[model samples]
Target chain A: MEPFEGKTISWGEHNGVIELSLHRGPCNEIGSETLEELESFAEVLRTSAGNMHTLIIHSVMPAGFCAGADLRELYRRAYQQPRTSGNSIAEVRNFLVRIHAVFNAIDDAPLVTVAAVHGVAFGGGFELALTADLIVADRTARFAFPELRLGLIPGFGGIPRLKRDLGNGIARDMLFTGRSINATKAQTADLVSQVVAEGEALRVAHALASQVGKFDLNAVRAAKKFIKPVPHAELLREIDIFCELFESPAVAAGLRRFVESNSPLPYLP
Target chain B: MRTLAQTTDEILTLAAQQFKVARETLSPNDDFFKTLGIDSLQALSLLTRLENHFHVELPDYELQDVSDFGTLAGRIQARL
Candidate 1:
């Protein structure tokens, strides 16, 4: 794919493996453009799903894998006086639904997927990584869900994913404290499959993908299919609760303060 | 309603059960995470249990720095 100025991903295929790198200058923030590209990419995968054996998600930026959602976009949507696109609030709510669908597409893809992470993967970024079948990170990688500090929850299907992967306690701790977890801690929590040396995440991930490619494609796909799907009902419920909170006074005041302060918001501790 | 000491004893009992240890093995001043070999997630689970038991929602922020049984009891005492 051709790399664009504001684009967040560039993907290529080699030896039945597709490697996609996310890049957005300093921090790869999940913005509208990134989501649009991912939507289109998911469609492409749907049409050519059989051709790929493994999909490796990585980051080209040095600062981090992704710093979660674009705060600017969120602030605008949350605090803007009038509907910017002449759409109703219900229409605005579709954005969350759209994100869930696209990420779900990736999660449900026929090919095995891996996330090669480094630096920081916060909020939605961590959610995206969790969608992968496996995550291999370097020592430099860090993960967190700081949305609670903003009085917003992880609206991009993160709650269900985290709850499924790490159980309710760990998920709630991360959400409530808004603290970052290092690669070692993430591995201990079983969120990361492997922890490599600094700057070796991509290499290790590619090696793992190559090994996975050696397996019988049918067996690999079948194994994935055998795993149960995350409860769709629960995911929808999370989105609903988050949307309700998004419109509450707490979230509104939090977003306004976040924008005004131009710094990380304070939690109780 | 439970007194402060009663609440503390109840919390310690819960903590001991969660860690699968003897009640006497834990002390009021012991750091729950350190003594119990539990992480923050386990601690959070204990917090949830405490909430259900005491019928109070512990403020996540105010308790972020709380580590030991004594401090935990003091926080609960304040709430009471």
Candidate 2:
């Protein structure tokens, strides 16, 4: 198979298992370029669905799997002058919509997907990892939904996917607390399928991918199809709620404080 | 609005359903994790259900030391 490289993703297929490595900024934040690359990558997968039995999304950068979105970008956009303008609002809305679509495509793909996560997977990063059919994390991996700290919510269908995996009770805890859960705790919660030693996430993910890839493509696809379909309406509802929250004064104030502090958000007891 | 006693009763009922034990078998003094043979994640799940049922967001810090059913019930009751 031909090796494929994009601005943010490098992927190749071997034995029906495709390894897609995310490489972006130091922490692999999902910026606009990364989103565009994912769009193209999804198209490639769509065309090769028949030959691809499994996919593993891992990170090549040592910084982390993904630190979520670019905080700088978020701060810049949130604090930009003329925030009330229709053009600015429309642009932000479209960006979120496009992101949700790509993530949904990944979630709805016929092929089995796995996330090989190590280091920090926060916000959008955590949501992306949750999209996979299975998650394999290293002991060093940490997952959280810190969006609420910034006066935002998980907009990329993270909340609904989390609810599906963990039910509302545990899911809301992660959402409300914005606290990180280690791989061991996540495994106990049944959020992670396997937890390997540090630096072994990719290797374990490859093994799992190979096992899944060994199955007949038809049966694999059929199994995925037979499973319950995601309630897409919920995702739409989440996006709508996120966009509305994004426009609120509270989010603006929160972003201002975050930018000014230039440090972790403090918790007032 | 439910009375404190009513809320406590409801919380116990919810815990019974979640932990899959007879309500009669549990008391307010029983440690939640010990009784359920569960962990923090399970506790978090219970907290989520309580939040949904009560329509309030309980602080995680306030819950860190709550190990028994009575403390958990009291917290929920206070929030309500």
Candidate 3:
């Protein structure tokens, strides 16, 4: 398939390995534009599964791999129409559905998938990384599910994926505490497959992709399918919980605080 | 166990080296936000560096009110 270059993301296949780069400025905050590109990419990935052996996702921005869902945009859109009119929750649910579709596509992709993470990967960003079969993090990589700070749970399949990979205890600590963990801590929890030096995540991930490519694609696909099943039921339940929480006054206040804050530590809870 | 003063000195040294500032330029009393000219994201990078150096997990929430090298050291010192 032809390479895609979009406003928020780009992708190209080289030597049977697809490299998807997240490049939106100030760290890739997933917004409508990103969702659209990801949807397109998912479609392409589904159609091109027969040709590729591995998929590597990484960010080109210095700030991080991704900062998570765009709260500013989320706030602006949510309050655009009157909350009493019931359109706000509807819009949020719609966005959640679309994003979940994209993430599920990656989660169940036939080829081996990897996330080359560095810098901040919080909230939905962390959820995105959880979709990967393997995460190769640089020393600078930090992961967290900060959704609880905004009076919401991770809407993009984070809890199920985290529980599936690291079990309930670690998942609960991350979600309940809304704390960020460094690459070393994440590796200790079995979240990261490898932790390389700073600025080396992509290079190491590429090397891994090269190694994965040498294996029989059929065996790889079958193994991935056998070991990794999408948590379809729980993911849907998470969306419902998120939407239920999004309607509360606390979520609005939290999003407002995040969007309007001038504090240097707004990323902190 | 290292003394608090030693931890503070180590933090200052790590901060200087990580941010490429002079070790002598960073004081225990200086607001690292201003001293290092770092925002929250960069501050977290510093926190990660400190955590790795000390082999401790310093939750960002605990550091919410902490801005000075001395206070930051105290937090790490407590965990240590």
Candidate 4:
């Protein structure tokens, strides 16, 4: 498979390991461009699964791995058209469906996957990391689900994936509080497999990928398939619930606050 | 148990070392955002470092309105 270089992301396979890098500036905020590139990457993964043993997803931006979905774009598109009609919600639901398809593809990919995270991985970014079988985080990495502050739950299969990987109580704590947990706490909560020094997540992840790549491909794929089943039904319900909540007046106000705020800590609730 | 002043002093030292600011320059009352010359993401990084240094889980929400080194130390002290 040919290497891909896109505006928001890029991918290339090396030594049977595909390294997909998220590289949008000011942190990779997953907007339409990112989703489109991610969808393409998912397709590539599907086609190249037979040749790949491991997939490593990490960000090249300095601010973090990803700050989550682009709320500014979401707000712009939502209000671009008339709000009197049902078009906004419909459009949002459609986006959710498409994003879910891409996330689900990664979640159930045949090869082992790792998210080498650093800095802020909040909301949709957290969901994206959840797609991986393992998360290797640097000490600077912070994981959060701040969507509740936006009057929305994590629409990108975060709730279901978090529940699948972690305890229900831990999942609820993150969802309900909308707080950011550091790499140490994330490891304690079993969310991160390894916590390396600052700026070392990608290296640690590569080492992990190398280790996994040496194993029998058939056994690795079988173990992944057996242990990691995609929560299709809950993911669908999350989209529905997100769309339902998107129509509320609070989301508009929340998105408006986020988009317009000049505060340095806008990500904070 | 460390007193609040001790905790506050440690926070000042950590913040100074992490941001490479002069240790004496960061006082208890200085707004860390201004004193450290950092933004929110950097602020979160500081929070994580503080949490690790102190071995406590200080939720970001708890520090939403807290911008000074002294108050941050108090929050960490409470957790301790």
Candidate 5:
């Protein structure tokens, strides 16, 4: 009935189809605290069983899906950013690194990770959908990248993931504008695998998961593992550029100012 | 160059397919917003699909002009 294990994300199993719903309801918004839960959840999903085949991520809200990282967290960080917070500066630093890790795990999972999205999925929410091997969107589902609007780049691999998922130009448009595109456009943009008739997102996703559950999990895992050896120089380029920005004083000040201001422009950053 | 009717049929058909709806549901002369009740998801999917299929990228600002079938058809025609 419930979906949590020791204050972290929980998984529900039925006929070998694991539904890892985000129970951090009210918004299902990701943040410093939830990053660890996500990372741990991904591990649980990925290493579940040799026979297990699918992982479905849905939210507990009626307007379900995620709202991205908490802006309140951003504000808190801006206010109390440590001078020399090495490795991970309390909340912000820890969250940034861990969220990326969680996404990587989701992307690399042996079984297909399906994002069953409805209502609003913006910024990190969009990126979270990007982490899925496939996405099933409801007709009313809204997808967006509002980070720029808040004067921040999506720290959890929005640009890189979008580029790899949709291509560079499309990624730029999504990132620079911070506009919310509807679910169908997201599918057309090749951002998702499919879209179902309204209210059928979760149902369709579950059906697909059942089908996936019948597959040979080991072979699937091995195939994914096989793709691991390819050169990641381009990925490294993106990460390096990102890290350079992280070290930028102008960026920090700009981010601080933007977080402080009533409105922040996401484009300049 | 393709005739307007031919172009309209070609693009609209592909766009309709992107909507994952039956071909009978969409028409060159049909009213898009009215007939399709083009809500945001449907509208966006149709727009993005049309853009990608035609290799013509219509930005969000441009999308605002296309509220109905006739309007969207006209916008596509103008781009051509």
Candidate 6:
């Protein structure tokens, strides 16, 4: 698909399955170039006929899936270096917004899209996995949203989706503490739909793809239409207020008292 | 049709499996978010586990109100 043009990644059909991969050496860093490739690929696949009955987003890297943005880009921006053609934080956020839209499109595509994850999926990479209809992960898959530790939230839809998936309280811990959930825990948490042996993520995903790819494309798309989008405007405000409340003596003392006792959330703690 | 008892059994079984504990330890009558030591993280974790396990999504508010084994079971049964 031309949506991901001039990028090392690829999208093509083989045996009726459309393969989507980040061919940029598996490291698949979400930089300026990668986001452009994703934007192009998503649009083309969204409309093409039978070109994407099964979309597989596999890593080309040996270590893991995507690792989010390049810190070197951040370092460059702080120094005002002309590296990525006006690569400001706003530009990066804009690109990620497009990336989020692209992933959303894939989730709603007529085909079944699966993520073959093995290794670390951090930040946006972790969020990208959330967008997939199915995540076939290996035992080595480590999922984390470490942005909160860096004073950032999931730039993509991770915050909203994870909250939707896991529930608000648990996701807040993930967002606040930035702790990771290992593969076993991921399977328990339903982060990954299936967990196979290490390095066999792609094979299992392809197998699942084969089973699902033959279904009615229209039906698959229809099911997605019925699914609800994340409703986080209120929750996000609550999160902000929660943060603000953390500073209040009322909330702080309330938290301490609640922690001492055993009161539920509607009360405190 | 699955009875409320059956759905409660399934949901509690799934939640127990998720938290890696004995289902007997979590009382159906106990408050989900506080009693049985169900914190918010574990609460969300259990809800996600239930969603993927059952292949049906509960409304966000319904999911939040699943504060006890009985309530969680009721919520799952209602969706069914």
- Please report, as a residue range, the 10-residue window in candidate 5 chain B with the lowest summed lDDT: B36-45
Candidate 2 residue spans exceeding 4 A from truth = A81-86, A264-269, B1-80
Among incorrect, acceptable, medium and high, the docking class of model 4 is: medium
**Highest DockQ scorer:** 3
> Residue A211's C-alpha lDDT in candidate 1?
95
lDDT of 2 by residue, B12-60 (tens): 8898997799998877888877887764435555665676567665666
Interface RMSD per candidate: 11.5, 10.7, 0.8, 1.0, 8.9, 9.8
lDDT of 2 at A133: 88
In candidate 5 the C-alpha lDDT for residue B44 amounts to 50
Candidate 6 residue lDDT tens string, B1-80? 78988777887677677667788876678676554466443454455466556655454444444466787777777777
The sequence of per-residue lDDT tens digits that candidate 3 reaches over residues A1-269 is: 78999999999999999999999989899999999999999999988768799999999999899999999999999985456666888899999999999999999999999999999999889999999999999989999888888899999999989989996777888888999999999999999999999999999999999999999999999999999999999999999999999999999999999989988888885
DockQ of 6: 0.04
**Model 1 stretches with alpha carbons more than 4 Å out:** A1-6, A84-88, A264-269, B1-80
lDDT by residue (A1-269, candidate 5, tens digit) is 22456342567777766787766654576765677777767666656644567778887675458767666566566456565644323445545666776777777776667999886777777778877778998765677776554435677777766766677666777777756666667778887777777678889999998777676878766765674322234434544554545554665675566557642122111
Model 6 residue B45 CA deviation in Å: 24
TM-score of each prediction:
0.73, 0.74, 0.97, 0.96, 0.66, 0.61
Give the C-alpha miss distance for residue A267 in model 5, angstroms: 15
Predicted candidate 3 versus true structure: per-residue lDDT over B1-80, tens digit per residue: 99999999999999999899999998899999988999998998888888888999987789889989999999999999
User: What pairs collide in candidate 2?
Assistant: none
Model 6 Cα lDDT, one tens digit per residue, A80-172? 456565434454445555666776676566667789987767777887888777788876666777654333456667766786667665577
Q: What is the DockQ of the complex in model 4? A: 0.76
Of 3 and 5, the candidate ahead on TM-score is: 3
Better of 2 and 4 by lDDT: 4
DockQ-derived CAPRI band for the predicted complex in model 6: incorrect
DockQ of 5: 0.05
